[model samples]
Target chain A: MRLFISFILCVISIAKVQADSFVVDKVYHPYVLPNEQEFEWRLFSRQTDEGNKLAQHIAYGFALSERVMFEAYILGERNENDSDDYGLKSYEAEVRWMLTEQGELWADWGALFELEKQHDSNDWEATAALLFEKEIGKTSLTMNFFMVYEWGDNSRESMKNEFRLQYRYRFLPQLQPAIELYTGHNYLGIGPAFMGIQRFDRQKQLKWEMGFIVGFNGNNKDNALRVAIEYEF
Target chain B: MFKWKVNITSCLLLFSCAVFAQRPEFVLEIKDHLFYPAEIHIPKNKKVKLVIYNYDATPEEFDSFDLNREKVIFPHRKSIIFIGPLPEGRYSFFGEYHPNTAKGVVIVDDTTTVNQPLEESSHVD
Candidate 1:
């Protein structure tokens, strides 16, 4: 446990050295059940020196097979300062692949791929990510390493990377408390998150999550709030 | 780019086919929201298929924290899940919708014979 904590601190230190773009989003897990289907909505709001920003996503996803799932999302954003700028921002398609059976390996493994296009412009972005999860007793640790490439007429072609980590303690079937960390080019944030699920008959369940994050970059007063709800059937 | 896409697609198809190939099969039945047999014995360290038939008018989700498996069996329908290749131990599972009455355990042991049918118990407490 000491070694694990040291490793986490080392990673966080490295991440903070060059961190920049703050991303407030839900952490993805590495499990995919066969024939599972879900509809999800996510809201993220951030307050920074520039202004306040809000983004929303609605997505529908289904498993293609035991190990693979596909999802599509409609994304919208509003600049609180610019009242008229609220509208659709982008469309995204994502694929998640479960690489290892849940306890078959020392740690579970998965991957994610995403392609996004701007609603009214030629801007596009593509991302590939590796997902890892390890369970120690009732606590679970998950991490994501992402590589992104952006290109198009409206944006400069560039490549970027991001890392996210979540450590969760499972106290009950319906509730779990977690600590999450996210790092990117110009931002580093850590926060507390809570998630729960309510199961219903006929293969239906509702899952909800919320988190509040504060930026750690020097002289930057940034805060973000994110929430998500998912219904699976 | 096109060639890369083709290669990835082909690899995924091959992997999917390999995963769906032959494996040891077992059946569990859910009636009146209770799991039949109450306990099942299987060989340890081997992947196996579990086909659950739900006879209740309402659906039930087979949930297990120990085995890390969760699946919903629809009313009057069957659902399939693959479990194990795990170490020898007792893994408990319960019906999410009827947690009070629908419960069972999977006993993974080397000495125990696999798939020995047991009389279905009428009640679980």
Candidate 2:
């Protein structure tokens, strides 16, 4: 309850700021492991509403400013009798800053810093990426090539980097489906994938996404599926 | 016979004007999270008028890397851009905010993509 009240107060305060002062021009990026279709604050709600607490994965989020969005998800030992998973899984938070409104030569974009912890690990690993995107008509395309770093007693200082390219279409202002391709060297292992999302009210929403992660060389391929609802006070 | 001759002359004039009036136009339509008629190709050095129409209540933008253009397209409204005598290459565009939902392409080259090529395609999405 306290968390909810704080979020509402934060929103009310941020509302006083002008849209031009920050780079948060749009919202959502439609794909999973990628981005959902970005809609503006005015269109945050449309097809569906973010569901109840049980329906949501063990997580919490705060939209501090238009340009900054933050989230944390947990995954510990699953207790069949318990309603919520209290285990601390990997931690991740992102901030999408608008660098510019200028043309392609100086493309304005969003970048994120994400951290993850292994199931039984103590130290946290991180992924740093830069997303340069543009909007054409009702379509938005983004090119992201980020590096994943490992941190541990036995881990290297800087581990590896990967590249991703994605394209999304907003068929309806609210219903957006997306396609994505990714690889280690931008082509190490290529895969085809998609995701869908909807938010019916201001900060309240629900989103669903699926991913077909294809691997390269001797690596195995796998499919990831996720469904969740979120509510903001 | 006189009536038939007059009708034929008028029809011919209309046809000629229609063919001559054909102007190249490009539109990126967002439907079901994908741009209908995803790919468009136009010849280089042609006077072209491009308009993007977003029917959804959410606003979208037409962005391209090859052509060096970016314009915000509001919901239920139209965004317009003009290109003249340009180079040849593949120029891709998409909605900046919704990269996951909207996308399309524009291929500018010496060749054209529509049949009966009428200078370029005056009708496209």
Candidate 3:
């Protein structure tokens, strides 16, 4: 228990570093339904002093079993300053493992591993993350701690760490409100998010999320808008 | 690295074996957006299998926040899910499409027998 507390403190301290960059993205939960499959699309747009940058990701995910899932994504980005040089940016593959049974532990535990390769370049990045979630009454708290390593001929060989946290209220099955926080090197953002689900016939549902995040640093006017839609069957 | 891979694979095999092992089975029928047995009793602290048969023409999603289980049961089809190894308590579930009528409760009790006789009460909305 002491070790766990120390580890959490360490992660928080790492996240307390200064802010400038915007890396606000999805906050994952620690549950995987058996034999589940999903198709998802996400959009992230950021407005900064440099210009507006937009990225979109399309992904397909499927469960291998009750405890494991795999997903692949195609990413694209367009920068306003780049003058229409927008196309495929990267390809990514990810795996998630549910490490603990729900409600059987103090907190549910999971792990995520991701590998990404840049298009038309020898730049690659890998990330390993720990996912934790706990339910308290009508609310749920979730956290992701990520360790990322970047390498390749076109990129600097470096290692980085990041964290994302979400606190959500379960008002109803269809609609939920949440507060999300993201922290990385030179990136700190907090915002309100809303997510909802619309269920169709047997094992099919559509989920949607929207969030607007603002950076904390005063030196730069940095903010981001993110939207995601998922179809699960 | 090879040793680590082997160790991980072994652990996963063991876990999967435990999960797929045969367990007590219970059946719940859905017709006209109502559960036939409004409540079920299962042994506490033991994993059990639940097979839901949907006779309605429209699909329904079986959802339970207390049990942390959710699945979609297609019309005229059956779906399976595992629940339990839980403490003694009452867990409620409802059909997402017809929350008013398609509702049921799982009663986990230490003294309850496996596959207990179904109660005659049928709840409809």
Candidate 4:
């Protein structure tokens, strides 16, 4: 009986730290397609005074209806402790619902719900975000406010909040330059981002984005580099 | 001097006529994130107005890279958009939020029939 009780305690303790261990995937857009499918891959790397972290993610996305879209992502990560060892980290799913059309009001709006399950640990997290977009001529801005709650046998009982912002200048149909900012508890980052799209035909297209952020506040990394590529058919 | 006066008057009248002419209009409806009449036919070489009504409780973005136009239609609301005196061809559009299901096309051709759904003609007699 004592051995079983100790085993239970161990499991609960592992679950707690796992809930808060995942990396943040911060780039987002306010548009949703009515009937489209996509396969996307993203690479995120961070360098701090303490250590370096790298994460890889693959996702499949499809429109559920005219205003709703769904996506699933498989994530892997490598940290200083793991060195070159990178393996399955977590599985995440999300639903995005567009709330307003572009130019229909002062700003466009959308909402997102996400759930993440960590591998080999009894840990999970749920997140919700409100997304906003606005455009004036060649300039556009987007913002996302996120609320995350983690739960499990050992998870913290507090809610975590985050905010991300991006501003872009459309220089051409396929290329744009942007600035991004992120803020969270004890975390602040600002960076320059560049993105472009290539349409191969009426039905196929490719998009790429790259960003470099410098941490500006406490307990945050000094810099991080993020990149994402998506293919739609 | 008499010929010049006649020419000036004709030009003024033509300008007024063009200014007063109204473009044809069509109604597109969105429900459950799908565009009604997935295919639309309109007269070629004429500007037209599109009145889109969204019946869903969520917003969707109407995007058409081919037409170089995009608009967000709020749920339970209506939006108006204008398209050009385009050449005969097919212009495809989709909901950016629900791209997989909200797909459609606008077919502009000279042979578009009068019986098709279109706004009242604004041609000057």
Candidate 5:
């Protein structure tokens, strides 16, 4: 565990050296492992008429119970038009709770709680999210509703709500094509996403997701791409 | 402090009660990344306990998007999951760690006489 922590720290420091635009992480399911550890890395790039931005996030997580998972993330971002240097922007702690067992209700549900602190400023943000997932035949739908509160220096203190929707077709066990939509106060994005899982052995597996988004309105970023890789052990 | 203690005590009692509740048990075995008895039939609208034993040296994640259930079974270990009182239908599951071969289903039947054979009486034939 100590070695894993060190690795996470090292990756985060390296990722901060360069990055800019921001993209929201997408969810495909709402299941948490029981008594296992997971490591995840996500890279996102956003392109607009003005400039391009890139960001990197590294997280270390563990399943505390069958229904609960806890994680910490290091976030870094940089803009293409700005200096070529990127530094750590913030730190985040998150907890995910699986609210109901699969097939136990009309719809499977979960929730997420997160707290983030910015590095250069005293700004802190708290987010609460509801996660819903349902499977019908070969298709699965997942949605997230998020409410955030930011405070302190340059803090908006006001609540900001966001919604994300994903519809995926399970074409194969290793490949699933998806469509994603993200909507917020002044931003709207629609994109194509793909997810897959590869089993290396009985004890370990690699899961990945990648997507590209095009902003629909003038206030939104013109283009964005997000990629995430997760390793479970 | 008094309120906190009472809350904790209540939680413990509830947990113990749940643990002691008796439910019909079924076993699913994982060998070579394949599930034996790939289809399980249980009466509809009744909760049941499923005990999964992974005989393989490697761990496997039992995933059923249709069932909304997922659990990681460690090598040579057993895990128990309770699923319930569901409508009549077929719920499919697979081992996430070995999706190619580990697949199974849960069939909830509403018919009570489904598992029992009817007795036929012959008089003069």
Candidate 6:
């Protein structure tokens, strides 16, 4: 009886964590519109061992082509943390374009183009990557590999690439069990990210989503959890 | 006089671009327990964007089995819906909140370019 109860509890926890990100086997950029270029506003707050911190992501997304969507975000103050409070933090923006959609009997695939500011240093510094996603049954997976280059300073001319992979299992409606792996040019490690989304009564116009992440590397560690709410405005 | 002509030509070009750049549009309004217009005729293989106006102040979701898209139009607010260049077919849709009240079809046919579903016989005029 005890073992059965423990198993049930574990399953519930995993299911809740998966709700924030896995639905279509795609590495859904933390901030992008899949179809329509509507103006979307999102506010995120998370708690780490350091303190309670909040950040806002204001973005606009619209389809550039029949199959392509472009989105840009300017991350406002990520203050509240010991490290962030010391100096001014630069705003970050990411633009992702979905290329194509593919699927098989039990598997599906999607391709995307993602550009993000690198090193969190300057807006000019950008990285471009090809993101691929595939899934089998309730298990969804994603792999994103990107190459970075300095805008004005191409002295090194060397391309720094990074890869991120996530696996999620959907057990309940709007809930899943998730595990995310990330490794890149300047940093390396793995973490857990969660996704949860719920629709309002009668209409799905109002959707609420939240995400949790805990990451650790060989060097310094970052174990943070994020919660965000959006009203499809 | 030559400069005025140049200015006039530029204005015309800009206007053309603006008109052509916008997506194809449709409007679906709920009235008398049914979708006004009953059907939407759109250009085949093109983007069919729609504005769903639920004037009744009741929440509703536009759902289409053939169009492969869905959107919830809140009470009294207009919801923008975008559908794609699907092959010629009759796509049926309905209101999830009030399925009995709102229902319609989106016919994607290149040969039938009429924006209103006034029947094939009527188009003969």
Q: Model 5's CAPRI class?
A: acceptable
Worst 10 residues of 2 chain B by lDDT: B115-124
Tens-place lDDT per residue, model 5, B45-112, is 77776778788898788887556567888888777666766688998999988888999999988644
lDDT of 1 by residue, B1-125 (tens): 99999999999999999766546667799998899979987788777777788888887888986776777666777776677776888989999779889999999888445453333442222
Name every residue pair that clashes in candidate 5: A19-A54, A19-A78, A20-A54, A20-A78, A21-A53, A21-A54, A102-B67, A102-B68
Clashing pairs in 3: A20-A186, A203-B72
Worst 10 residues of 4 chain A by lDDT: A15-24
Segments of candidate 2 deviating more than 4 angstroms = A1-57, A76-88, A101-106, A117-120, A185-192, A216-233, B1-125
True contacts kept of 3: 0.04
Q: What are the Cα lDDT values of the candidates?
A: 0.83, 0.49, 0.83, 0.75, 0.76, 0.53
TM-score of 1: 0.74
Task: Give the backbone clash total of model 1.
Answer: 7
Query: Tens digits of per-residue lDDT for model 6 on B4-79?
Result: 9999999999999987766666777865446777888877767666766667655566765445355555556665
Instruction: Give lDDT tens digits, candidate 4, residues B1-125.
Output: 99999999999999999765755777788888899979888898776777777888887777776665666676777766667567889989998768889999999987544333444332211
Query: How well does candidate 5 score on lDDT at residue A172?
Result: 67
Best by DockQ: 5
Q: Which lDDT tens digits does candidate 3 get at residues B42-116?
A: 899787878777889987878986776776676787777677677889999999779889999999997545564
Sort candidate 3 into its docking category: incorrect
Q: What's the best-to-worst order under TM-score?
A: 1, 3, 5, 4, 6, 2
Interface RMSD, per-candidate values to 1 decimal: 4.3, 10.3, 5.1, 7.4, 4.4, 8.0
Candidate that beats the other on TM-score, 4 or 5, i.e. the better one:
5
Candidate 2 lDDT over residue span B1-115, tens digit each: 9999999999999999988665566655665546666887777867465655566676565655445454555566665555444567666767665776567777778865433
Superior candidate under TM-score, 2 versus 3: 3
Q: What is the TM-score of chain B alone in each candidate?
A: 0.73, 0.64, 0.74, 0.74, 0.71, 0.71
Error of 3 at A5 (Å): 8.8
Task: Give the higher-lDDT candidate: 3 or 6.
Answer: 3
